[model samples]
Target chain A: MGKRRTGTPTLEEVAAHAGVGRGTVSRVINNAAGVKESTRRTVQQAIEELGYVPNLAARSLAGRRADAVALVLTEPDWRQFAEPFFSEIVRSLGDALVDTGMQLLLTLVRSEGERQRFLEYARGGRVDGILLISVHAGDRLPDMLAEARLPTVLLGRRSGDEYVSYVDADNAGGARTAVAHLLERGRKTIATITGPLDMYAAQSRLRGYQDALALAGLRGTRSLVAEGDFTEESGRRAMAELLERHPEIDGVLAASDTTAVGALHALRAAGRRVPEDVAVIGFDDFPLAQSTKPRLTTVRQPLEEIGRAMVRLLIEEMEEPAVAWRHVILRTELVVRESS
Target chain B: MGKRRTGTPTLEEVAAHAGVGRGTVSRVINNAAGVKESTRRTVQQAIEELGYVPNLAARSLAGRRADAVALVLTEPDWRQFAEPFFSEIVRSLGDALVDTGMQLLLTLVRSEGERQRFLEYARGGRVDGILLISVHAGDRLPDMLAEARLPTVLLGRRSGDEYVSYVDADNAGGARTAVAHLLERGRKTIATITGPLDMYAAQSRLRGYQDALALAGLRGTRSLVAEGDFTEESGRRAMAELLERHPEIDGVLAASDTTAVGALHALRAAGRRVPEDVAVIGFDDFPLAQSTKPRLTTVRQPLEEIGRAMVRLLIEEMEEPAVAWRHVILRTELVVRESS
Candidate 1:
């Protein structure tokens, strides 16, 4: 990991071979940039001929590229990490970038101060590009970044339509499929537990459920519905509330795996057997799906695909700014286990 | 976000403030090596005042840092993301770096080629540093990274005196506390379902169990020990094995929350009531710990703290290379719930 090579090739030697500046030679080898046309080629050629591998430890002393990227989470609660969706997405993103010879940086922003500071840093060229995850609606970060026009990709779409690129799962379609499955199962007493509706994801999922129910000629039933904030407790509370309100409920749909977990707990506590007494289905096929006594019958969003798609979109936009902003929606598969 | 205060600030402001040549300003800001020391400072001061952030987004333009860090997870299974450990560590690491004005980049390198490519990207200045997690003993990536002298901080350490930095929990102490509590409860025929022992964390936990047994003059019995890989399915399998080997075992200890969940399933499947016929304890009190039927008595590693520590150490090392290689060991607490 150094500038050492056979024949003691100078920066000049490398530049001459690659037809670029000594600086360009340094930049490309160090994965830094700013060198002009044909410069990178010359430098790369020189390095290949001389078999020169840039030494990271020695590079700091040479006053060159630090060669690092930071990954910002932009979330606060520590418990948020336990969410399988987040971890799985990060894993896939990291794997893809690593193959590209890039590093994965992780950061979490809980407040406006941190957000501003991070934006400043990004503007300061502290990062090559940013991979952002924004949970709440109406967060003004996307526009700020867009105006800056930094190479940034978001986990979710901005609330409004100012130019930006993003990758998201087919949350609505997955929910519709989930609801359709329940309808096909012919559980007349269908019910639903939704996540925080403020989130576009939650809203899309809710819409999917409604569309499916409407197709089956079953209208929305308030007594058979409850709102959860995507936690097991909320799911449990919602399920218990549903049971209290409609004891005859035989089919249930939850927005997430955690909520479904809560549904399982509530149903079990109430002495209701799954699928037999009250059928259950969940989304996100989180790790918990299999551990439950009656394994969860759920929908699996292609997490790796989501991550790769986000990176792909970001890189595409970064390469060609004139390209129109794109929205990528991947499909989801319903995985049936014992519960349903 | 307005275009008036555009991302590319005035270079004249930088020149005026730095009190250097327009040529020197070009050299320093563009990262040319010929700029003198004093000239560099002036240009830097000017650049800072004008808020002249460098541009990395342009397809052809190049200068400045990547502003991201790569978090490498050595785990092979993508589904393992459901485990809270991956999420908690990632979130904490992300939180710590957010305000440090760095973007977070995350990657998973499960194969040799991928690991090599990541190392290349990192050494190539694609990232600033790396924070790694859940690496196994047999994996060569850790050793390769260390040999390359890449700036890396691990969530847990491997065997031997490698010079890499890390932040980890006091697994041994935590295990001792859990086991000691079980012993104090007067439950004999104790059994333990441990994570893969090849991992240093797992080994330390096993040592804790042995230490506790010895303190109580109870020789550690192989018959009561079964191995798990820190998943619910593994715990269930181990529990079943332990039951077959030691039918009269009345107490159980699991290395992780998932394992404990599996043990609960196994106990119930065998018609053994929790805390009545057999008591159990688990580790890493994830949110699910509270939701477990009888709840779960588990060890709570300051997962967030470890994340913070890893980032802190890596940043400190970056700022000052003279800092001693540190092994930051955080505390772990035993949170008792109904299972015990």
Candidate 2:
């Protein structure tokens, strides 16, 4: 083997070792798209062999001096701000960004003027990228940001036809597993409380619940479904509405843990014992799930992983404008507790 | 009265009417400090008469290109991130900034490298100002940023000798009220569980506990005290220790709602009935306070208002470097619930 150089390896040396032009090495290092996969692999290998570390400061200076990304939450209801899911995702995102040297700018746009100002600021090249969460259907901000070429990533899609990159938990699969668990427990009358149908996640989860029942040779009718806005109060009201219509629900699949908590309260008020009279399962397995009486059985999504994946995707998109629009859906685990 | 202008009033018109230099008019219009109160009022009256509105875009371009502020949290513990307090404050701050057209960048620094990088970023003029929260004693970041002439406002101070502008809740007064309530209930042996000593809020709460006892002619020794880290688990552990050492303790004051929940759990595990057996009071009336079994009586601090005030103070400092340093302490209310 040749004697190892004492100083940091230069781009020219890496290119020479990989037998490529200096520009090719630069593009590969910067994660620019359009390079052949094999060539990219070769350049990566050369970089690994030489241990070439890109100077982040120099790269940021050459690009834009602002080393910041915006984490925008588009929820109009401020009540949702208290959800444990928000804090969990934010903490995970902060942890993921610790090593990237990029700050997370948290902007909540509840008004049209604020929204317009944010879009203008983002488009003006003040922020390197954006990570938008809690987007509702028919929201134009995501499309506008993407159209402006502002390197945007959504936490979840507005619908199936989302054009921007996003990382989401497998909501449908989680709901399916929740219903299947209830079915295995010999629950004949299964009902579901869904989040607002305007969100794709809620719609997907409702679909999964229906699919699970159908797969089990059970019939799920419209009477067994109630709509919720994912708040505990809504869950309680929906549960109340369901009971008034069909009081024989032996099992329930709530779209979120907060809703499940409300369902638990409503069942207690109705003189029903958990798991014995009505088995209930929730999604998102937040801390409240464990704290709830009888300990709610819920589907645990990899929130931290989702956050890390979002940062990774946003970083990739920012580095290479040509990177394909990617959609990532992580799996969920069913944590069986006494509530189920 | 002068005839109403057909279009937007010019800065020159306001300056001429105010009978001051154009620079002085600009300073007053922008809310910049260092001008006498009388002169400032005169300029403001002139601007109001002319109905002049400074162009934000022009002001941003003429001043610093960046119109963003950093909200820094000093805690290295990720568990603290899940606290409801973080979400509430963040949402409120976002709401306050909605009309300002400025963005909030959240930077969580866990490691030394991340902390150094963030300090350098702020000192390098990448952001216009900073709002710091959860500050611990001897933390150098706030001092460093303030010394570097960056406009800084802290949610709570590191200690009583803090020189920076800050907005705090009446922690000591709240704790005293809690103890007084316990005294009114005829509980003699009142014990206190404190948050981390490094935090000013925690220390003030402890002081309040002692002062209340002293005022009531009840001796409060170190044996009646146990330390917590403002976490549920810490509260549980502290409650367990207090019970072991002073089984006769009849009243408990927890520094935070989360800690109170843990204390309640510990009391239950030990077969102690809430209120009837061992009365408990918690600080920060979070949602968890109401959800806890038998409910938790807590001190309700104006958390949202504190957030808004922090933003307001930071904006003032940013607009006027010579603004006098101000400290604000909002009052807390004693919320009676089943726990007490």
Candidate 3:
């Protein structure tokens, strides 16, 4: 508790206060597991009492890692910012990083200028690795990071031939399972509301729907498939269009739960009873799925598992830069409720 | 782009590629405003082509700022993590920091040990400032930060007499306005579902309800108040308890929109008509407020404005450390809808 001669208390002062060597205090500060529990406690107490603040910049300059990871959001649309998917993934990522002693730096790169700025920031050794989410097709940020030899992991792939490290859900397989379930329930005429075709996940989902129909020896007509942007309004519009073209449609699969909610609204407006008139299934089984009227039967993506996998891959790449890029796709489950 | 003989491309190579001086390249890399648009483009192309990455560690060691901010979440409850409030605030903060070239480092400090770890991380000079959210009353992290001389800003106060810099919405005023609105609608016996009183925001909201009733020459009875923890389940339990205690209650004020949704569910279960039998008002006009059966009337906190203010104050403090800590309180507005 003595007044420091300098501006802030040093490691030496903490060691002196605890009657230990400076190296012991350093070991404790670094959270080295080799230190004895009792000695670590005494050093921690002295450090807390003395208000010792370690200089990370100096330590990093001395060849220690920055011990931080950057979680970059590459999507520019503000509407996606409000989606439950984003928050869920972020929370899961935070949970995965809880014990790693590595902080998550959230950055939004909207334009080319901002992307360049982020590259420089990452290259400057501020972060040990990067986790990217919502990256669009043809976005060169991933390739740039790869060329720069920075360790990076992406939430989803840009294409089936994506060379960068990524963790993706079984979007196609989930959609196929939903369609198969609807088929098993004696629904003859089926329709689908797909997400935007430009994205790989959406394309994969559309493919799944087609594959399921083909496997059942049925051809999916063009009129029965409508494109949506994964928003509620888009879903409503697509659903209305499908109903208009084929009023006998007995089954519908939406690319996302939000879209499914919109579809439900449209169906209600048309006085169609859920399951009795139109069996509906949604993807991403968000919390809203359980609260909707009739309760949506949807496909639940293993989002937490995806987040953990992303972190694991990024850490591996950071620790061993020569490691090959990895692509991990986690399985999805069909959650049955009242809607189906 | 010349072939690099050593490790990665250097700044000098980028300057040579751009046909500019090293200082000019540095200026462009730092995003200095002095560079012409055309010159900036040329320098940028060179940097991109050469894949030159600046050493931020060296730059920071030479007295340059890290140009990064740390956003610390002190709340440990996983349920709260799923709330829309957290995502909205984070998006707003990201928007505010867009043009500043400052990255947001998100750190969750759940335990005292993690709090100490965060302090070391912040003090290590990885971030230029810190923004704290979901801090509970009597938490000493703020004081510890102050003693460490770190430029920090809190989303809400720890207490009424908090000395740290903070930006908060008028929770009490918002609640008062909501209660007043219910009374103006000729609600005779008003009850309230309160959030957890351990938090300052919840306490202020409860006081606001009492103040509004007292101002109207009516005493708030102890039997009319039920405690909730801002969760939908808590709201439902509290509302059911309140109805049992006072079945003749004609109006109710909920601490949050989530709580109000629960109240609405309980009223429906009891066969009570919305505006005709029991009018209800909620705080925090979340998107869910609009999707409710009766479309809840609620108080709208200026969350985006609060976020912008926090960033502004932190940047100011970072620039001028000697500036006195400022407390900012933004006004809230009531959005009238169908429920009340």
Candidate 4:
């Protein structure tokens, strides 16, 4: 089991340097009781001298590691549950973790107290690794976990300069593709339902929409852009606002499938035919897209692959803590359907 | 903290009985080393004779318990991810666990190896309690958990004779109400699309459909029944088969909203209008019910309440291991809309 570490020092080496038995070194590393204070100090000195960082997989092989990872969702809002994106990502991540023999512990930290408690639990070696999703730009969890020297991975980065390992879909690229397709279809008055601008993904998507309109020599006006929080009702209300501002809008790009469903409903109620009167598209081609009447034409983010990538990256870091941080950007494609 | 147990033996009493210090009793109960072997043996004997179950909440307050719970989903199919039911329940469960400060760990065991590994992990005292969902009749998880004496609560029962504590909705009664509503609307030829019969909930729903028809002096025929696995595709296929067998059928009761959505699609393709040529009713009035074209008139199950109830029961069992097993049956209501 220790042979996997090619360049790393073994527990036996640390024990030898500390002039203690291997079991003593193991107990000290695992923070288990029974080690004498003086002997533990010697082991710590040896570890510092050798710059020893425990190989997570090797520790598990020795039956010291917990062999569990925490998937943390910190959104306090229960309304987020209505969006199927998080659940789908969780299922995919669970499937990816199945063959790895590691259990997935899902932690939802809503308040500062809960966040601090979870951080303490993770720092105390309750879980071997952590996967954070739906993290906000202002969240300190990623930094805290990194500071604790815990092997942590993020589904999406909190900011562009994120130092933590993460995997994210090309939100901007998907939005650009949606807008470009609408332009190609000769839709003169294109509009977009943007998600809350505070979110990095939402901000990037809005940029893409703006860039696409700029390329077509059309200024993306404020009147053509309405804000939505990625819910159906928000989308409906936003669409109504957009129509009142620009009734001639012939193309729509919603930030999410639920929002698109709402846009479709509002358009239908306003007596406009989909694709004929106005072409509509959505992001995240979840099952809701297929179940819609016109069958939503949307950008399909590889959610399952994104989940698998997070697991793979986190495992790599856990196995070799000295590895550098990685940021993977997965591509998204447009799924053409009746609505577009 | 020990003062909370008014009737139960306090740690101080146990320590006195064992002729040891209170700290020694605490160390022994927490399995913290440093106590002499003889002292640990005496504390164990005193605890056994005194029938001390160790107040879990008090233990947690003292920062002794792991303060974590596991939510297990044993369904192997990824298609289950598309169901909004699981997501909503998870949200509610997460909300319920918030004030308790116990983190929720979600485990999806898909294979025999995974199941065995999870059972061992749970039995090893990794998590304080478990909340299981989507378990099948043949699954031994509930029984294994019960045998391990771990505080466990299930979302639904495995069978009629299930000994584990559970919270379930009135599936049969909801089905009967749906059918009776269809009958009141003067639908002469009513058919049913049932979920897989292996699940007790599905069986109960089919029974209710038959009972409703029987009450109106009409015998349910083989041609009027089609089975689905509670998916839209299965629902659509079942509806197609039912239509082929009984083209004159004027009413349909689907076991789930997803299935009913499929039935609506198939009916439309067959040139049949909903509630005119056929009145369709679905169970589980999720958000998808409102998104459909004509909308779905289905049975509204208190999914969030069910989640809270499961959490309440599991916490009770954890706080008092000797408490009697509880079986909570929640009520369901019919939500009328355009479909029926």
Candidate 5:
């Protein structure tokens, strides 16, 4: 880690690094009306090199800084914000911005039009920085923001090779641990519930499940798999469908705790005893894990830590653009509980 | 109801409605940094008369509009955001902002210093508007913001009348219904779990609980009453404490589902059969309500609607500054399930 600057580095250092006119550096750094990007980049490069962290406290005193940061969540489902997974991140992000004495702007870009508007707000300097989360397939928000040279950090990684700073959990490895636990239990007829396939997290979890089954020489039967949108209702219905298709299945692994909770309900309704007739496990050991009957053995995503990590990465990127883009994969743990 | 504008309205209309000059209207609306109160009021009157709304979109074409809004929640507990109450509001707030083509920024503040910094950002025009949720006692945030005359609205009522707009549910009525349900079940040894006494919601819920007991002519046992922080663990612990204090207690009305779920766990662990040994009811019909074993009979807070209402109130407050501040109290309903 680089030593923290005593104060924002001098404009002279910025000018020296950018290799531009002192006047040009002043114009760009000040965001003075007529500076071009070529000039802006020179100034940005100079600022970046000189460790010129915009002092929000001093800036607030002057009321000259943009004084705001925009949080761009590219959610395919708008309501997922109600889900604890997303809310935790927002809370942390908000807390971090408060420390900087910066206003936080949250945007949900569900459609292409929303994304365009978001770009306008972000690029127009309405926000000094951007934080992106839950990017889906064909989502171009991250790329656009990065290409525009906006300081951005993502909550999760994008699949593309482009260098982007992000913080994510080891989803595939976590799923494998979950499935392997069921395998070692001698539960032969195990089924799985997957999240939306378009999402990489979902895709990775599914892949891990498949890899585990292949290693055990178990058939990846279509009947043993069902997809859910990570809600308990969907989990219950999926479990029901899985039971109907493969009545002899003895174990289940769900993508989330809420889903697993639903599965438990379905199993109880079907007169199946947990860990006796059907052992069940879930991911993201939410508070509901303990709340559920027999409790739930699930994968702990370290979501709060993930939130903290994302903020840290975003702060790093904001402070040093030349800093290497990072993929900080937090480790996941398997917590054994009554059900599994 | 007023018609939503398709685009920006004429400046003349704003000036006429505000009963001020075109120059004054231009200065205030454009945020040109200097305008007297009387002149600004006249301009605002003219604009209101002309049915004018500032053309942020048009201004953004010049790359100058700050299209982001801030949702500042004065909550310290991390678990509070984990609860469905805050998440639901955040989701609805996101939806409402999306519809209006504004970005939402979320921030958490607990201390006086943090509050001051947050207000500084808002006053600096970092965000187009502000949404404040003050959960704890003696939170002067709403009053401070309102006094600063920032475009602001509260999620719940403040201690004193401050001419600020707000949206809240009928918490007292909801709690009353919950307790009443307990009495109807023929459970005479009724007990209740109250939320934090410092909060108005908690106080109101307690009032409702008392109201039901009073109407039923049943003794409100001091030993049977417990207080929880609206968490499952707190609920569980409170239930255990209640049982230890009053082993003969046969009915319970918990302040939140999380606490109720905890109570359920405690009851089952203590070898007490639910409904047969003791009846349980909780508030906030979160997903946990239905997921609970025997299902938790709870009071539905219309969480999403409350969130939507908060956004609507905040938006209206921004649109019409002198409009009568509204205190919206949406109704709650009792959801009967197996628990009681």
Candidate 6:
């Protein structure tokens, strides 16, 4: 093996050493397909031996893609940043991009000033595209990126009429399934603890709950619903309020697993035994669901599939630049456990 | 507000619109100091109004920094990616970089081939610096990065004799404090479940356990120690084996919170009453600590402080490449709860 040279080696030297053309070396360096495996290995060996480092900055300036994507968090709440839900999404997205040779840049935009700063960063050609997660209704960052001609994909939509490309789990369908399962267990009087209604996912979940009750020929009264922010505290508060107002309720559906955990605490405090007095179900089968007392029956979102679909759509839009905006919805399943 | 023009706008056009000099606009765009706050706001307003996007690629080709940092994960185990430890580090790092106008790029290098590709990417100047986490002993990527003259910082050291800059907690001291607490609680016959010894953190923790026992004038026999890999399953297995081998053990020290939870499970299965028949302590007072059956008494590392120190050191090194490498060790405190 040759010792590393004090001076940098050029592409031509690596090509000559590998006994291949300069183009072959360049293709191998860029990770472009079509190069023979054996030839690629030979060129990589020569490059390693000579310590030849390609100038990505120069390649990018010469009209080549940066081969990077930005996963920007648009939520203003810092607490959400530490949630397991966020971690799951990031893990899945990182796994999805591992083989694409594109780096994932994580950004947090909490305020309008930071949003403008990120817009400039994205438009500056530092990334091939952008992936926005946790975007709330009325957020204009997505439209701004679209106007700037940057390929952008979102993890969830702001509304049903979202124009930007997005990949979302079937929130309504998942909620409907959860409620239907409760009905099948012979629970006639049911109530719901919903997430903050500003988000479309929360709205869809509420709609699903209402639709399930209607389908069962049960009247979903106004007193049967309470609002939560998908937080444990909110869930507890909502559950307590529902218990106080409607003591006859025998079934409860929480919009999120965290909320369900809170409701469990409230039920225990109120002297209600799970599945005996009041059966419950939650959404987003988080890891915490399995650890709760009596466990939790919840709706499981296909998070990994959602992450992969978002990446695929973004890459397609980046390559074509004129591809129509797409909306892909993945299915969710019910994971039954002790609570339900 | 003026409508966005069809053609791309230049820096000169932005300066003309803001009624400022081209150099003034350039300084504002680069986020360099010396421009008045009012002038900076005016230039920003003009840039946003005209939809002017700076070319970061050309700026990099001109020898300017990319103003981005890479947070690389060298761990090959995919399961670790979803751990709360990883999420906390990423959240803190992102928060640290938010006001600095530097984006955080996340990369996972699991295989040797990916390591070589990352080397070329770093050498190509895609980022200003690197922050590595979960590096195992004898990992050569850090040294390779150092040889390439990149500003790098590690969350934890590969070994005590690490030459690269890093920020680590007082792992040994934390462990010693935990064991000392157990001793002070009048518990003799104590045993320890150690983390994988290959990791410096784990080794230090084990050393601390032995030192505490020796200081207390008790024999730290080999039979009182079992090794684990910081996973819940490993912890459960190690604790079960220790119980079977030495049923007289009255107290236990687990290397991590997850491990402690597993120990709790094992103790429960064996019908050992905590703090009565047996007591347990854990490290890394993670969120899981507070929610455990009896709640967990564990050591709390200053994770946020460690993150801020790492970012500060990396920025200093990037600004002055000649700066001497510095090692930062933050203090840890013990949080006592019902478990102990």
Model 5 chain B: weakest 10-residue lDDT segment is B56-65
lDDT of 3 by residue, B1-340 (tens): 7864743567888999999999899999778788889999999999888767777776775664677898888877756765677777888897898778787767777778778878877777778899999888978999898887899999989888888999999999998999998888899999999988878899899999999999999999999999998988899999999999999999999999999999999998888999889999998888889999899999998888998999999988898874698889999999999998
Off by over 4 Å in 2: A1-65, A95-101, A226-250, A257-280, A285-300, A315-326, A331-340, B1-62, B95-101, B181-189, B221-252, B257-305, B308-340
**Which of the two, 3 or 4, has more lDDT?**
3
lDDT of 2 by residue, B1-340 (tens): 7986433456788889999988999888667889999999999999888757554334443564357788887778756776678877887887787677677777776667777778766654557889998888978888777766778999989888788999999999999999999999999899999999988999999999999999999888999999999888899999999999999989999999999989998999899999899999999998778888888999998888998899889888887864578789999999999988
Q: TM-scores, in order shown?
A: 0.75, 0.70, 0.80, 0.68, 0.64, 0.80
The deviation in Å at residue A83 for candidate 3 is 4.2
Candidate 1 lDDT over B1-340, as tens digits, reads: 5545434665555676766656677678657787778778867878877767543433112332455677877788765665777776666776788667566656667677767767766655556678888877777776676665566788887764545788889999999999999999988888899988888888888889889999999999987788889989999999999988888888898999989999999999998999988999999988879999899999999877887888888887666643567788889999988998
lDDT of 1 by residue, A19-138 (tens): 666766767866775766576665666787865655433443244223334556665665656566676777778766755544565665667887786776666554556777745676
Q: After superposition, how far is residue B124 of candidate 2 from its true place, in Å?
A: 2.6
Candidate 4's displacement at residue A298, Å, is 5.3
The models' CA-based lDDT, in order, is 0.76, 0.85, 0.88, 0.85, 0.76, 0.88
Alpha-carbon deviation at A180 in model 6, angstroms? 3.2
- Tens digit of lDDT per residue, candidate 6, span A198-278? 999999999999999999888799889999988888999999999999999899999999899999999999999998999
TM-score of chain A by itself in each prediction? 0.81, 0.82, 0.94, 0.82, 0.78, 0.91
DockQ of 4: 0.13
Which 10-residue window in model 2 chain B sums to the lowest lDDT? Answer: B56-65
Q: Could you give the DockQ of candidate 1?
A: 0.30
* lDDT string, candidate 2, A1-340, tens digits: 7996533467788999999998899999768998999999999999989767543333443555357788988888766766777878988898888778677767777778778878866755556889999999978998888776778899989998887999988999999989999999899999999999999999999999999999998888999999998889989999888988988889999999999999999999899899899999999988889999999999998998999999999988888863589789999999999998
Fraction of real interface contacts that model 4 preserves: 0.21
Question: Model 4, B181-235: lDDT tens per residue?
Answer: 9999999899999988888889889998999999999898978989999988899
